[model samples]
Structure formats: C-alpha cells, structure tokens
Target chain A: MTLLECKNISKKYGEKEILKNINLSLPSDKIIGLLGKNGAGKSTLIKLINDLLTPTEGEITVKGKPIGVESKRSIAYLPERTYLDKRMTVQAVLTYFSDFYDNFDRQKAEKLLAALDLDPKERLLKMSKGMQEKVQLVLVMSRKADMYILDEPLGGVDPATRDYILNTILSNFAQGASVLISTHLISDVERILDEVIFIDKGQVVLQESADELRTREGGSVDEIFRRMFRC
Target chain B: MDFVFDNNIPIYIQLVEQLKTYIVSGALAAGERLPSVRELAMMTKVNPNTVQKALGELENLGLIYTERTNGKFVSCDSEKIYALRLEYAKNISAEYLAGMKKLGFSAEQAVIYLEDLGGEDFDTSGM
Candidate 1:
C-alpha cells in the first residue's frame, strides 16, 4: 500500500526554487534511497515530507491524511544534522523519545545501544561524531512508525560505522513500514535499497526499482547515477 | 567466514548468500561460533544494523541459531546449507547464462567460455 504521497509539491527560498512540481508515492515494506548532488534539494524534499518546512505550492499526505501532529506521530525523522541535545546523556535522549513517540520501543533502543557499546550514562557531547550518529539512528529505528525519513544517514561516518548504521536500520523497524533514506553516497546504500529516486536541480529525474534500473542500464546504480549526472 | 559484497546486489541478500556459502563449504563448521555483529560490522566497515539484519535473515532461514548469552552459531543441519547453496548456484548460473546469451553467445560457446575460464573446477568448497 502507498503510505505517503506528495502532489505537485514545490518550494522556494527567495527566488531560488528548491523543489519544482514534485510528485511521488512511497509504498509500504521497502527501502527507498533518495539520491542527488549536494544542492540537488534532497534535504529540502525531506524537510517537506517531515513538515519541517512548508511547501510553497502543493500538499503531502500520510496514509490519506495531510501532514499534521497526527501524521508526525506515525513518522520518525532523523535529520541530516545533529538534532539531539548535546548535554543529554544517552539514557536521557532515549527517555525523551519514549515520551514523545507512543510507538517507541525502549527495549529495542536499549538493545541497540548495548550492541553499539554506547553507555547509557555517556553524554551526547562526550560521544564521538560516529557514536552520535549511531545514537540518532537507534532512536529513529526504535520507533514503530509508518514512515521513516533518514536524511544523509551515512554522512561523515567511517566505513565501519556506516555498515553498522545500515545494519541497524535493516534489523530494526517493523515490516510494512517504509523507509526513505536520502544520501549522496549511492554505492554504500544502493545494495540495501529496493527502489531509488534520483533528484537533480530540484526535480526528480528518475524513480525506479533498483533491480530494474540495473537491468535497463546494464550496469550498477552508481554507474547509472554517474552517467545521469555527468558534466 | 568473510563476506565479499556486490554493489549490484542488495547487501542483506549478499550477506545471506555469503553465510550460506560458508555453511555449504564446511569452512564455517556446523555449530561453529559466528563473529559478533560488532565484530562483523567493524571488519566490513558496515553498520552493525546491517550485520544484524543479515544474521536475522540467516536465523529466519534456519541456517544459523542464536544462543542468547553466548552469541549466534552456525546451524548443525548441514543438508539445509547444501540445499540452499545448490539453489543459489542454480539461480546465479541461470542469470549469468541468460546475460551471456543476450550478449550473443550461444549455449555451446558459453559453456566453452566457462570451461576456458577454469570454472569447471570452480571450487564451492572454500566458501
């Protein structure tokens, strides 16, 4: 079933168009990798889906309802930047998530924390950047939401941590929930993705199943992406 | 056992295939202890979550079993692994042959090429 849909979505900052006439639907039970260059407006699209920013000219719906507090409750978001309070300990951060999200699975979150070797008492500020990213992912995945929007999830992490983060995402989360992951590092996430949506210059250039795309191009997703974005 | 991932295939699937290879080859002996998720993640430089997914998939397929406090171990049932390996090889070989045919190679020519590439003795024993 289609869990999320965006219709004729458009956004602008001053005169610069960030997203233009965007329309997309996310089906349940798949991992979608959203690809674009640094300024291809990938983040803008994510913000629109999470309702962090309002679209200038369109509407987004979650489960047939427009985005609002009710929709937000069923949607888990991990922004590209650090959104967690640095002063809070790992335990405190988890508690905050539990309080806000009714579907938050505290046990699952704690299990992930233990697997990552992150102490509950460790302050967010004291943890390394990679550790912090893992913490953020743990919280996001712990929520049994209908939709998960992860922006640049592997950004700035070492290769080892990247794999761990990817694994965590794969292992956690209930079936039938859709995950939308936005990233520029296509090669890393390409293997886990069921479908891929390529955005370029504020427009969705292509959206297709990863396997079909590879079959059509006779090459890997990264290769196809390079060709599509070739200068 | 170490896993070599292909970007063309999904990581989780690649992982499942790799574990199956080890089990089939006996390199990862039945009842052998598998690496911890953290250890595998650190080795592969992948997220622990991805590793967990791979392991979870294996468990679901009954190719591996978890011992809770001790960690996950390779399943003792050898036939299942062998069967999985056979199925995997059939699918992969079929895909490869189909691709070769699409490239204009006849069946006989494809077989000849496979033999010439020393794939006849292609050992599935080492995983």
Candidate 2:
C-alpha cells in the first residue's frame, strides 16, 4: 500500500511560488531519498507532509487519509534542525517523547543513545551539535511508526559517526515501514536508498528506483544529480 | 566479512558478486550457514531489502539455498562450487590477458611472463 501521497501539491508566498504541481506517492518498506541542492524546496515538502505548512493547492494524505492528528500518530519526523530543549537531559527528553507518542520505545531509544556513546543523564546543552542531532535521531527512530521523515539527518558529523548513524537507521528499521530521507549529501546516503526523488526549484524532476538510475545513467545517484543540476 | 562497495554499481548486484567471491574462494565455505537477512544487512551496513534481494538472486543461481525455516546456506554441491571457481578463474584470466594485450603482449607472452614472475608456488602476499 502507498504509505503517503502528495497530489498536485504546491506552496506559495504571496507572488512567489515555492513548489508547483508536486505529485509523489511513497510505498511502504523502502527508503526514499529526497535529493536537491540548497533552496530546492526539500524542507518545504517535508514540512507539508508533517502538516507544519499547509499547501496552497491540492492535498496531502497518509494511508489514503488527509493529514491530521491520526496521520501524525503514524509518522515520526526528525526535523533538519534540533528541536530539543538545551536545558533538558537526554533522559528527560526520552520521557517526554514516551509520554507524548504511544509508540515511542524508551528502551530502544536508550539503547541507541548508549550505542552512540551519548550519556542519557547529560544535558543537551553540554553535548556537541552532532551529539544532539544523534539524540534527536534516536528519539525519532525509536518510534514504531508507519513512516519516518528525516530531513538532513547526516548534515553535520564526522565520517565515522556518519557510518554509525546510517547503521542505526538500517538496524532499527522495522518491516513494512517506509523512510523518506531528505538531504543534499547524496553520496553518503545513496547506498541505502531504494528510490530517489530529485526536486529542484520546487518541482520533482525525477523519481525512480535508485539502482535503476545507477544502472541506466551508468553512475551513482550523486554523479547523476551533479550531471543534471550542474551550475 | 567486510565489503567496500562502489556506489556506482547497484548495491544488490555488488552484494551478489561479493558473496559469490567469498563462496568461490572458500572464505564462505560450501554448506556454511549464511547470516539472516537482518544480520547480513546490519553487518554489511546496507538495507535489509537489498540483502534479501541479493540472497534471492543467489538462490536462483543455485549458489545458495534455504532449508525451510532453518536458514540460508551456501551450496554444498562440490561440482557446482568447482564450476563456479573455474568460471571466476577464466574471467580473471581473460581480464589479465586483455590488460596485457593493451601493453603490447600476446597471450603466449603473458603466460611466459606469469611463469617467470610466479611459478607453481602462488604468492598470497599483498593480495
């Protein structure tokens, strides 16, 4: 079944259009990469799916229903920016998540945090930016949601840590769940992506199987993106 | 086993090739039980679906098999393993000959150079 669908979606700000005629249907049990350069409206599309921003036209649906509280219940989102309170410790944030989301698995989150070498009792403010991001990822991924929407989960990190994060994503991914990852760092995430959606200037340029694109274009998704969107 | 993947190629295809290499080279011995898809995926740091796909391909190729609910295992057929090893050696030989040809050496000259460089005793160092 299609886990999420965006039909004729568009976003605008007064005279300017941010996204136009965007149509995408994400299937279950796959990792979909939303690839584009800066200001390509990747975040805008994500926000729309998460119901943070209302589309100017058309509709967005999760499991054939319009975005709402029910839809939010089944979608776990990790925003591009860190949203945790600096004063709160990782443990406190985990408790907050546990209380807020029925599907939040506190034990799983703790295990993931420990794997990253993050101290649960340590305050967010005391941790580095990358560590905070890892905590955020752990919290989001611990949920047993139908879909996971992560925006730039690999934005700031060392190469070694990036591999750890990718491994965590792969290891904890449950069956029948779909993940939609949006990022400008294509090469790092390309290997795990089942499908790739290229969005530029607020419109989807291409959406196809990642391997099929690699096989047909005779290069990695990163190379194909570079070739198609070169300056 | 660790695998360094080239992102240019399909990941499942790479998995299939790498697993084949391990089986033919005895790194993964015949009849050796393969890791579960999830375990393989975590070990390989690739998606589970990709691992499953590669395993499915290997099963179709008769390089691996499933024993009901037990688990997947490398083919125990000696003839099959031998034939696969021969095919791999042949391909490597063809590629080596082609490289030598580009450097202005005939197949006969390549064989002579190979004998002089390393006779019957194969040097496994720096491999």
Best by TM-score: 2
Local error of candidate 1 at residue B38 (angstroms): 18
Model 1 segments more than 4 A misplaced: B1-3, B8-127
Per-residue lDDT value at B14 in model 2 = 96
Candidate 2 falls in which docking quality class?
Answer: medium
Tens-digit lDDT track of model 1 for B90-110:
988999899988987776676
Tens digits of per-residue lDDT, candidate 1, A1-231, equal 989999999998899898999999989877899999899999999998888999999999999999999889989999999777899999899899889889999998999899888778999999899999999999999999988899999999999999788878776767678889999999988877778999999999899988678777867789899998987
What lDDT score is found at residue A231 in candidate 1? 74
Model 1 chain A, poorest ten-residue lDDT window?
A167-176
- Cα TM-score of candidate 1: 0.71
In model 2, what lDDT does residue A9 have? 99
* Candidates in order: C-alpha RMSD to true structure: 8.8, 3.7
Error of 1 at A117 (Å): 2.2
Tens digits of per-residue lDDT, candidate 2, B1-127, equal 8898999999999999999999999999999999999899888888888899999999999999999999999999979989999999999999999998898777877787798775656443423
